[model samples]
Target: MNNPEEKEITFVMPFGPQHPASGHFNAMITCAGENVVDLKAYPGYLHRGFEKLMEYRTHVQNTMLSDRVCILDPFSNEMAYVHAAEISSGVEAPERAKYIRAIMAELGRILSHLTWIGIMSSALGLESGAKIAWGDREKIIRLNEVITGGRLYPCYFMPGGVRDDITGDMAGEISRVLDTLEDKGKLYDDFVFFNTTFTTRTNGIGVINAEDAVALGATGPTLRATGMGSDVRKDEPYDAYPCVDLEIVTMEKGDAYSRSMVRRGEIAASISLIRQLLQKMPAGDFKVKWPMTKKVPPGETYFCCEAARGELCFHMVSDGTDKPYRVKIRGPSFSLALAVFPYLSRGVQIADIPAIYWSLDPCPADMDR
Candidate 1:
């Protein structure tokens, strides 16, 4: 026991690999009683050194690595890496294929966000919200099964195009699924989105202004919530984004609530974009039909896609060989996860830590690569 006149002491707590809220990484936060004084992130528990492995594998084989690397997202990872390889190889997919790729990518975002909603809601003690969100997410996963013949990690996207094309009836089936999803979105609004407890709990916590967000390298909904209306899909259109229409949704507050709202808005926007893609998709050859074992010309290129999280980027270098010379991946979560420390300053309650972290939607696998 200390004397009454003594100053308060600060200690560290590791909110960790075994934490109930976050999955793998650990947060070492210095706390003075209930308030956090400083914080740091320690990631790498999920590290598989994925980039180095890509160097030794054939170009076609690396697709498997990229798609699986970021477990939370799907098409964006495969699309980004493939686009880079295509650039180096002087190959392009058919117009119809681009539209289909766009549709699949947007579907990936919807499902990823639904999973996010379930996990985040569960973190906040919203049990009903979790069940409803996950239950609806399954509907999208079923759609993936219909399209790609696989649920998670579809392995559907290839270098020049998708592994297969959608049938007319299958397209109608997806449209109906989106209709059900829209209704479910309204249910989410009713139960969780506008809930008093949720709003109050998230409103002011983990606030980061636009400048601070950019300085810390935050991206995706995390940066958009700060009123920076920047999205790779809008600013730098790739695949069918050039032909289709969508909004770069942003919120002014830059708080946890704003971030959640941004993701919520994106879900609806993606549904609309998918409908347009399916309707306007031109009829043509699905692919250029390049050999998987062919060598790419000696060159280097970078490609970026607006993934479910943010700009999932890839850099590829080829030396006129079937295998890549080098591959580098840039994941938004790595910087966004580190950015949380700035928000954990003195006077922030320890309880806000998990909420703030989830708001960034950190995926440690992205960092490990």
Candidate 2:
């Protein structure tokens, strides 16, 4: 029962700023006949000018701002920036400090992946999965608070070492939290992965081939979904990664389903890493003694870390001053956001755009910063 004389009118829909699920930004989609013709992402609504602001602040002061780059994975920024300063000034962290850094980094990874899984489930209308994912995330947040005295933005990593030491009680608490999460993780997998509706909605949707993924500069789980095993933790071992065993998780199908599965697998791996780190942690000075003046020599240094999103690189040029001469934060979210827009607009319904967008896990603040 179709009308021969009827015509479809294309319209643009704005989804953002105050939507139920569009985290931290707004997205506009132009649709014609149920298919999205174009999509534009606006992220300046909360621009804080982090890069330019870092140039005006001292190296120590910049650590506070780095955490705001990606609110979910703030520790990764802390480690990356501190490591950059450490490398530039030829100051190597002690053995115990390196182990502590690894623990914090892995814990941050678990928390970030959990948040993404929860948000994605909510986007797909899987309310039960979202609840379970976020509830378990609370345990990880508690552990972060126990170690660094801060839940979201710890700022615990200094130039040469950590801000405080992880004592016996803190280590035991982390182990107990991991045990609880392991039990909860199994139930979550059964509810989400085994559910027919969840699979039908996500499987084979927003498919990206290996070649396309590589050409578009995709990294982390997005690249791993295409069967590429390129993780900075494995390729370039930094801090305590060399002391512990590590594994890379990858999937053959580069689709929404594959990306979600890869993230789940990474969460499991991060838990294993944390448990091992706690058991074999050494005893030493938590903080290295540095000059009170806090001056870094004149030089340019490049440092990269495997953030929860992807590879986060920091290129800093110092002029023997307290503040940096130039600082550039190469966030992986920027590249992933660009790759998603072009591929998501054509031949897909407007309803599917949210799934595709969430699969990319684009942090708008990271992109605009």
Per-prediction TM-score: 0.96, 0.97
For residues 1-369, what per-residue lDDT tens digits would candidate 2 score against the true structure?
Answer: 699888888998887766465777777778897988887777676678888898888877888889889988998899889899888888988888888999999999999998887888888888888898899889989888889999999988888898899986888888898899888877878777667767888788889988888887888888899899999998888998987888788999999899888988998899899888877888988878755347889999889999999999899999998788888998888878766555655678777777887888877778777
Cα lDDT tens digits, model 1, 276-369, are: 9988989988877768787999989988888888878998888999888989899888788766444534468988887787878888778676
TM-score of 2: 0.97
Which residue ranges in model 1 land beyond 4 Å of their true spot? Answer: 1-7, 341-347
After the best TM-score superposition of candidate 2, give how far the Cα of residue 368 lies from its true spot, in angstroms. 1.8
- lDDT, candidate 2, at 260: 85
Residue 151, model 1: Cα distance from true site in angstroms: 1.1
Summing lDDT over every window of 10 consecutive residues in candidate 1, give the lowest-scoring window.
338-347
Tell me which residue pairs clash in candidate 1: none
